[model samples]
Target chain A: MFNPPTELLPTATNQSGTRTAAVPSVGGRTGIARILLSRDTVMIYALVAFVIYAALFIPRFASPVSTGFLLLDVIPALLIALPMTLVIITGEIDLSVASIAGLTSALMGVLWGAGLDIGPVLIISLIAGVLAGAFNGLLVAVLGLPSLAVTIGTLALFRGLALVVIGDNAVANFPPALTSFFTSKIGGTGIPTVMIGVILVAIIFGVVLHLTPFGRGLFALGYSKEAAIFVGIKVVRAKFWLYVASGSVSALAGIYWTLRYSSARSDNASGLELTVIAAVLLGGVSIFGGKGAIPGAIAGVLLIGTINFTLRLGRISDVVLIIVTGTLLIASVVAPSIFEGVTKWLHARRHRRTLPQASASGATRATASGVQERK
Target chain B: MTLDTSPPATSETTTRRANGFAAVLRLREIPVTLALIALVTLTYMANPLFLSQQGVKDLLLNATIVIILSVGQAMVIVTRNVDLSIGSILGIVAFSTGTLFVTFPGIPIVLVFLAGMALGALLGSINGCLVTVAKVPSLVITLGTLYIYRGLNNAWAGGTQYFAGDRPDSFGALSVDTIAGFPVITLIAIVVVIIVAIFMASTRPGRDLYAIGSDPEAAKLFGIPVTRRVLLAFLSNGVLAGLAGVLYASRFNSVGATTGTGLEFDIIAAAVVGGVAIFGGSGTVIGAAIGALLLTTITSALTAIRVDKFWQQAIVGLLILAAIVIDRIARIRTAKKLRLSEARDV
Candidate 1:
């Protein structure tokens, strides 16, 4: 039942060094039009359309003040989402990202309160994150444990450690200069100065994911681990490093969150994993892995941020925002499959009409339709 | 279906296979049970009052709600699917139970339970339908529903909480009254575990669940109704969660939007630690029940021994990781053993 050529053909590398063959050409169309209609492009279009709509219809939405708050709000999600896009592309998840951030925040608060200078405190907090990531990588990558279960464990473990570190306490006496710098805008753009750092992180993840041989290997790993190994991808090492990167980025988000809010607490960023995941999924990333883009994920983060900000501006409750997010997540994954099913059914019906004699035998009709459906 | 027609070698292998399966089942419960006993004994040694009648009651009561939830969760997990919205389902149902008592003022307890369970079934079927028809992973679907249901609960409960005082004394007594040294709610959980365990062990449909979970494609090829079985699992899970919710309303001081928030993780952790495989297919409700008991006991034991309460969660996390690692090791050993045995036969 296994077709050797069908399995082998896609793994063949082309001259451009991109695994472009892995992406199926839609509707027999090639090149620019196909790229334009892809899921990532569609997500970008939706983000643009939603932004325009919010600007036109919502009051006070077009101002730079709105931009400042929206971008600030989405920064943590945008940061974590960079590595999350890669993780999901490789068919695993790290639910502990938010908890790692919480742990980092708690560590920062405790270290700062214990009379440590801010510079060393920041570095130690990030190292703590890297260690947490390594622990996860050790379990999931090295030991071959399921990432979901392992991360769920670490999710509680890290948060629990955070609670132990800062028990029901909030540290708010951060240096005023650093805090102000965190919220400071560049010139008259109303964007936070911290955004530059976030952008650099995003770019690094994007370049690694989309421009490197290692990133191509990640896609192959997601599609089929055995095949990835066959093609000489160091699947285990790549996954291990991806998790480390995720932890480091999550820690950075933690530092930014603490300074931007000027508070460090154990509960910092609790429940944020959901929002990060929802945004990533809405960005055209397949949860089953092997498909996604960083730009689309950034757009996803911003689109959600804009919607929430506009709703907040309109005096709408957070409840509605939650509902909107959940609905969007479900629709994003469900819509494509439903569209494909409809197309298949329509194609089968048309074929039946054209070849009336084909429907004479039930078995023959089923086989004919199935074969056409594959095409 | 008759094994007598098979050759002697085949029959011998089948018998050996049966023995191995039985051994694994028995082995799954041993470690958790041993751990639970060890924790209790150590707590007792630290503080004799830990085993006092009141302390014992408290431990059972603490575990009752979790035990009920974990049993339900084990059923869904056994089907190779998960229902992350159980916490939200419990929240909504608990709130509804509270509201029912507050509004009706004199409603029968049975009617309230029915209403809560019916609501849960409705919600669960929505999840089941979406998951089955969508062909999407249960994780994503349930995660979406988790947010939507929690959002709805927030909208509905909006700072309104019904306390234990709002319910009738009889309803409150469900957690208070002890029958043969067991709280009524704990007894209810025990009965649920027993009944569900029997259903799982003896029923054809129950066996089909294990098949579907172990390998969904193979199960489908073998003519198992994967969609229907999976939907049933979710429905039953919802009903049990609803039952837990009503019990929550009775035992806890208040029921509101945030009543069951974050409980899903604890329940999942319990199921996993109890030896219900996280990826599904080979765990029993009984083990999960013991796992729930073990976790709740750990919290009480820590408090009794004067360990910092903050360390409880960390310990639980470690326990989960340890359990998964152990399960993996055991599975590998079994695979190796089976390979060696098959090689000898060849």
Candidate 2:
């Protein structure tokens, strides 16, 4: 049902802005259709379909209270994911996010338990997060150690620090005012301030990634460190800042988690780094780095949340949900390859049909004429 | 200029001697083995009972499962991939093997081992398909499967735990039995190490794995069948992890949902500490196995000395840092030498 003229595809020299004028008519053009089947587009459609389905079936799914709850739940992860998306974009990972958050949470708990106020605790936590990130950044960007190895080592380092600071105990019973502000509804809208904070952070990330030169540099660095350095992109500094950003965002998540739970524990968010990463992958961010968007990641978070909530509501066993999630993950990755194969097969078939038998006649006629001349 | 008084033969000899020294240093385990010996000696001074027959047995027995898993994990990590689902796989197979033993009272214990391995292989192949055929990063694919497998185990077990009384004497004996004054399980781990070492050093496909992990895109360009080899790596890891699970079950004589929870990190830690680069392309199976043994031994010795559990985490963190520092120095020296060689070649 879809085909395109061979000439419509751009050649090597078509670098000018006027190339759009050469676009073929839309009817039966497989090129545009293939573009629609791109991974990002597929994820976007899947997310939209899920949201619509949720809104239709679940009575309270669209209500202010539930929406507020969902947004609040996703805020910390979204904030952490913002910087992680950038870090991964630049071809690195921070496995220490959860541990860093745990450390921050413990720091907050210990300070508050010792009779400090919320403001100072928050400041200290943020600073700690930034410093932790700087440590990782320095190790990777300056020392040139592999990010994975460095991060894994820091995972234990940060977690151990949290343990030493907190010393095997849970802290709860925060001042009512602090906890209230964290969980409070904004008048009748039912959305908490924390959710607002997360949205603002996401917006900032989106603008930065889309409008800034640093964003483009990240993509360049991911594609090739040698090329980025050759082009004077300040690869090391860019990488260092990426880690710092990831650390800061993870701290923000930690603060929100502490506020929401009204407690700070050393083991808070244990094993959560995996989920944050899963959201990023599901959002269509290439794990290989250099491609992603905040909006796509937010959509991915929502999809996961919906799936989790819907499965619970449906009373399905956890095992079934796991199997389904596994299946979904596999399908998501598999679909692109399948689509590419089909497109290649169609292109080959089209080319074979388009070539004429008269080409054979021409060759024979030329041969016969040559023979006559020789005779 | 300072050495101008020295003869050219003296300088050449010095260069050769330096190269020889480096070859010895390249053995990788010298530092770690020394550290392990120091730790053991210190523990013995702190309490001679730590080296007693039972203490030694406890250390070896505890280290066996982790050693097995670490050898397998080294294989995957060397290929620049990870198997996060190994813990979950261990959990599922452990419980499944237990459940099978319970349901079929007449089934031979030997068959249980085969069945456990088969189940693990099946789960691992699923990961391979998702990672290779689907082209997903191993991290995400394995993370999904981690939860999926754990959830399956949880639901299947239904909060039920099989206790020591439920299993036959043969099952427990598999772990407890001694061969020439060493636990049979420890011997099994050693056997695993020897086999994997041979495979890694003597096989064509194994060398290809190193090439792929060093630079996957380059490997593809060199016609290495990148996806197929990666899938095989994951499969091997899965089977080994399953075998570890069986060993875990046999040793403890207990199986439950929580069994093997959070164990993947320990396996990873051993591999990393053994000089297996987390980003892949370098490491040794024997090094990884020794790393596991060292970690387990330290834990047992520390507990015997009545050290606080909190100290365990601190020590582990410090050890990891020390290992990374050592790794960094070695990598820099290697790079400098390689650059020097290239300059000379030019």
What DockQ does each prediction reach against the true complex?
A: 0.48, 0.28
Best candidate per DockQ, number? 1
- Candidate 1 pairs with clashing backbones: none
Q: Give all candidates' CA lDDT scores.
A: 0.86, 0.77
The C-alpha local distance difference test score for the whole of candidate 2 amounts to: 0.77
Model 2 spans > 4 angstroms off: A1-42, A345-375, B1-22, B215-228, B304-306, B342-346
Candidate 2 DockQ vs. native = 0.28
> Each candidate: RMSD to true structure?
4.5, 8.9
The candidates' interface RMSDs, in order, read 4.8, 7.7
Real contacts recovered, all predictions: 0.49, 0.40
Worst 10 residues of 1 chain B by lDDT: B1-10
Can you give the lDDT of residue B66 in candidate 1? 97
